[model samples]
Target chain A: MSSTLLRTTPALRGALRASGALKATGALSSASFVRGKATLPDLPYDYGALEPYISGKIMELHHKKHHQTYVNGLNSALETIAEAEGKGDLSKAASVAPLLNFHGGGHINHSLFWENLAPASREGGGEPDGALKKAIDSDFGSFDTFRKQMNTALAGIQGSGWAWLVKDKSAGTLNLVTRANQDPVTGPYVPLVGIDAWEHAYYLQYENRKAEYFEAIWNVINWKTVAARFEKS
Target chain B: MVSLNTVWQYLALQSPLQLHSTMMSGDSFNLIKMGVTTFALPALPYAYDALEPHISAQIMELHHGKHHQTYVTNLNKALESHIAAVAAGDVAAQIALQQVIKFNGGGHINHSLFWQNLAPAGSDETKLEQAKELVAAIERTWGGFDTFKNAFSTALLEIQGSGWGWLTREAGSGGGLRIVTTKDQDPVVGGDVVIFGVDMWEHAYYLQYMNGKAAYVENIWNVINWKTAEDRFLGRSEEKNEL
Candidate 1:
């Protein structure tokens, strides 16, 4: 992750280091430039570690196949955009927006998602503590309440998308929001925790019973990572 | 004997000639001359609530009016931009627009066929007996209707992401019934006759069925319009008899 952080600014690198997110090495490259290639990151834990809650099969496919596609797509879109812009083909460059948004968002979202998970035997599941816990309680009533609300948001998503627990920078408040497809959490809201609602995330294990997947995933959620992100935000 | 596949192959070759004429024509910016057709949402043949219990009215309204309509709307918008790009000879822009066109266009095509593929839950069209030829083919291919149903259901469940399951027939001689799947709004193309397609996207069943996908797949048979499938299946035979 530190090596990949080479693409980002020093301030972002500092923030990431402070948040303890740097330990999930190789999970993200932030943004890869035209010449930079976004590669698949190494998971902090083994695939089978998140078992019972999220099957190893699902994890392997999600991380390898799905995430790899997004990485390849994002790198390709960035290359195309750079080439088009170099040719002074502004229209052609602009036309690549959808691909950039889809693939780029996918890459960012999955990178965050992997860090937010851990094996149940480790720092996974359980409630958050310290400043992060206080924020969750204050903004969303109680931890239990916030969990239920997040689950509800996950269920409400139509087609394929994600439900994120985000923080409003100005207000210092936590909010739950949903994004259609791979539309990443951006703007003023800093995404602290994201749960994938796309069918591929859970279809193999939970089938169409997505609510179970949503509910069960919490068992493997690395609160430490989320807390770090929340505190940093 | 001229096989249904050969007849379809002959017809398929004619499209490129028409497309070539449209491209070669000097009418710049003429959408009509380019043969770019604007797609519209087709009205459902039955009432929204007609497939109640199996598929709720709310789901139908949203699936047809909202979901399907969005596809039609976006596809038209993409086509408009695509035509402009073509006129400007912006090949890169045109290439970029291809994906959007494919996604939205496939959505429109799939949903249009999906609506017609279903009848009222207990209606006469739902009966397998009504589609004798298709039923016979199913029996011939899979040995029984139940076996075919199970296979179709399994395929629908196996789709990893958003997609559709279809029963299609190959064109020409030696081609027979086959089951296939397409991911993320990809419509069935080529020489195959699409007997029917079942929408596997979560929006198709999530609201009404709510994660009970197997149940949704099971109940879908109750509303399947086998009559339409029979007609599509026997179309070539009917033409052959005329000849």
Candidate 2:
């Protein structure tokens, strides 16, 4: 299965393209297609860019090893589905749907994750200004309150998962949500920011101290990119 | 006297043993007639250490005492909130609670079934008459015990993330057996009655098996309580036949 076929449905691609987040982040451009195979999107910055807050070791392993596995799995699952469909074996496709979700979600979430961060030297840390700031204040009371809520929600996840700040397009409001083990933000919500709470994301640096990791993550958040995502949504 | 409708409802809702007991014990009839029941963590049929060498005592302790207990607790909590939401007609709240209910409820159901379907190796229960019937069925459906084991293990290993692999009797397929897998803690429900299931969740095997899930899959066969699986298969088949 090619990356193009596996990464997103045609509908999802249209949504992403419309949102302009995919274009803005240059994720679509960086995506190298070898015979339409799904390839890992290159990190926008150096692996060590978010160092001190997130060790370069973690970023390297996460991006190279962890993210790559999902790419492989997603492509494999897509191939399986295609072959099953070719044989008119829908049961085989149904059985492998979980893999598609898990791996495809992994690829999507991590792709967003890499773009969601920037170096502290690059105005990564600090508060959002303009419409994004006003939306935050209006929806979640204030920036501090939003931060606290996100931290609490992220810390409360029982297992490997992610915490998201998503735009509910229908209601036109920002909401905080959590998903377990590579489940993407589905439905009407367009994800603006996501924090990986999986053990691999922080175990080496924080060692079960999820609160500390969550706290440190804020320092490296690329607020400008998040603002762009919010605006696009 | 309970209304005839209430009796019919009770018969529809209650488990076989509960129904049988309700019929036998007049004092308990009124309580069950009102439709109040809660799930609890069942006692392990054998000592925690009984399946050691194949599965560690520590793994059993945490898997049952900690993991399974947490699921039971959370499921109860979710159900409590769900009941209130349904009573209040809070459809949004009910919708939000669906994942909570499925995760905890499936965890509870799967773990409960998993415990019953395992025993210490070489036990008398391993090869009883009931187990013989199950083996015969396995051979018939899958073309022999070894083939069935291989196919089941392959399915179990292929579960990409946390999930369960089951040998279930397809309800409308004339008692046909199929090996199926489900993601996360989703329970094997619908018309399929699970005869035997293996937990592929990391927590189920991570402590003892680590990343070597193949080893865990291989070793679990040693502890499978074939008699219990046979009983469940026979019981479900009998119920279907009666219907």
Candidate 3:
């Protein structure tokens, strides 16, 4: 790396920033986007490290504000869900179901997204090796096939939604399923890999057509984390 | 994996004054008439940290207070002189300044469009049901809403570079479902009327997804204000003429 970039680098800043979830930054800092007690997730790396891939600005807008809103909304909705469930108010809970699902799902998806993404030099966001590749081949015929399938499935989602590669514990396999909006995976599975199909997930850059963003995000894949997920499953 | 090396941050820090004329604008705006950065940062639609988890607060601060603001500031400067040139008797200067004016101007315009494109994740409007007509139109034109998303997403995914992928509709055209990519600084409005636009320019994404444009696009959906989008769609009928 160039000394110029290395000089103004970010270090330990992510952890410090994550700790900031509990406090208001300035007089204008908003507590509205926060609802429940969950803390903000620190970025895996500095804001600029993802440069050339993700801009520092988009990252700032997307992570700090966008994801936090979901976290806050999820916390708020959960309170209602719990109260309704506690009272055995299934119908009421059902009424609030969309909120829990969308916001909670948004929180969950963004949390996973932050963890899955990383800078290029790190082992975080890069191409998979060995077993992950082999699995990609066995399941989808080839990496390209897997990519095409993922993009198609993700783009094919209607309205607000998500596309996921969930690890079905029962079948002992990964399944690609697209969920409408924040609908959770109501099955005996874990998300091996997933993509958030929301406009804020991309829009500022990729715009109306989501396919391009999906195809391009492959560059920063933290395949190692995914491999770990596969092993855990 | 798509190569991250392929995408680079293109920051045109050169003042628009060079590209534009030397004259200035006396026209008043919503801002102060005096000293600033010759550019002012744009305001974010929501509070900072509104979209968390999916996006980080630090990223938002820099993205909004820094990146988007730079574009807005630069655009204003570019336009200040271009408008001045036009006011004077400099047709050639105005013509030559068009590209810079458009690029920076479009950047500001597109980013402004983008700021509202999202809502707090999970902010669906159950109280409002105005999106039905647009949804119905999608089903009619693209076979189904699902099919339209597929085609639209495909257009976005397959675009070669940093450009927008939009679903434009005209009076005669039910829906121009196509994926269009603009080279650096070029943004094509979806409809002549601009139902809505996406800012695929790198400054928009370089913060979060880096060169992983696909991931950025997918995440954008979480915050997409379908209601607003639906409104844009509703304002313009597929087969009706604007005139």
Number of the predicted model whose TM-score against the real structure is largest: 2
Query: What is candidate 3's local distance difference test score?
Result: 0.58
Q: Which lDDT tens digits does candidate 1 get at residues A159-217?
A: 57899999988887999999988887877889888999997787667765678999999
* lDDT per residue (tens digit) for residues B1-243 in model 1: 222232223223234345345456733346544344445677789999999988989779878987788887887787778678667766677667666666777787778778878999778889888789888889999999889999999999866457899999987896699999987877776767788889999778766665567899989988999887787787632422221
What is the lDDT for B144 in model 2?
85
Model 1 chain B TM at 0.85
Instruction: Kindly report which residue stretches of model 1 are placed more than 4 angstroms away from their true locations once superposed.
Output: A1-233, B1-31, B34-37, B236-243
What are the per-model DockQ values?
0.08, 0.17, 0.02
Judging by TM-score, tell me the better candidate of 2 and 3: 2
For all candidates in order, the CA lDDT equals: 0.76, 0.75, 0.58
Q: What's the TM-score of every candidate structure?
A: 0.53, 0.66, 0.43
Q: After superposition, how far is residue A22 of candidate 1 from its true place, in Å?
A: 22
Candidate 2's DockQ is 0.17
Error of 2 at B192 (Å): 4.5
The sequence of per-residue lDDT tens digits that candidate 3 reaches over residues B1-243 is 211111111112123463232233432221133221244444676887887756667667765776566556666676566556646647587666566655665555455556656677877731124367766766777798778766766667644334566555553454543334444445444234344455564445555665566676677667666676675675642311210
Residue A190, model 3: Cα distance from true site in angstroms: 1.7
Clashing pairs in 2: A3-A37, A3-A38
Per prediction, the TM-score for chain B is 0.85, 0.81, 0.69
| Alpha-carbon RMSD of each model | 15.2, 8.4, 21.2
Steric collisions counted per model: 6, 2, 64
DockQ of candidate 1 relative to the true structure: 0.08
